[model samples]
Target: MKRPGIMIKDVFKRLTMKPVTSKYPAEKSPAEPGYRGKMEFYVDKCISCGMCAKDCPSFACVMEEIDGKKRPVFYLDKCMFCAQCEESCPKDAIKMTTEYELAHLAGNPQIVK
Candidate 1:
């Protein structure tokens, strides 16, 4: 246990330094190349192969019959954003976007069609 005076130098140094954190929500920072964020599903490009649902480790991608065709219903709440669905899509229907602001009120699952 050192004296209280010992920490004074460190305190002063830190106070003089600029804040490392950015002002988020006001000043948005660009995501790096290949940075996976949100999942975007292209309905037209999808072949209803169910590969994305099969590859998803979190079970976020669930296939349902829509308009007599099997389509993926994404539950963003359960998604880990691993991008496995995007990789498994043979038709290139699923893509990962740079939009990371996915927060919502409780009971809102943030489901994607």
Candidate 2:
């Protein structure tokens, strides 16, 4: 139980304070450097080494046979985006981009093939 005078003083202090939240949808903020958001896979750069799939902590990356060669398939829904796959790639095929708006409807798989 707080005193009425103390409560009133606290209320006045809070009312004068500036808002701590950002205008998200109305004003987009750029992602900082080294902020891992989405992944971009380059087929031409990939050497079919399967190291990216093997190093993924969330098991989001799967090695699939495509055009007679093994390629890494990214399941964005299952991915934690820790950038382990990007670090493990020797050919620099997998790179992380800062585009974070990845919302999609349920049951639709966000697969990067």
lDDT of 2 at 21: 84
Task: List TM-scores for all candidates, in order.
Answer: 0.80, 0.80
Lowest lDDT sum, 10 consecutive residues, model 1, at: 1-10
Q: Which pairs in model 2 have colliding backbones?
A: none
Superpose all Cα atoms of candidate 2 onto the true structure and report the RMSD in Å to 1 decimal: 3.1
1-113: candidate 2 lDDT, tens digit per residue: 85567688778988999987879989887899878988999999999999998999899999999999899999999999999999999999988999888899999988888
What Cα-based lDDT does every candidate model obtain? Answer: 0.90, 0.91
Global Cα lDDT for candidate 2: 0.91
lDDT tens per residue, model 1, 1-113: 75668888889999999998999869998888778888888899988989989999999999999999899999999999999998888899998998778899998779889
What count of clashes does model 2 give? 0
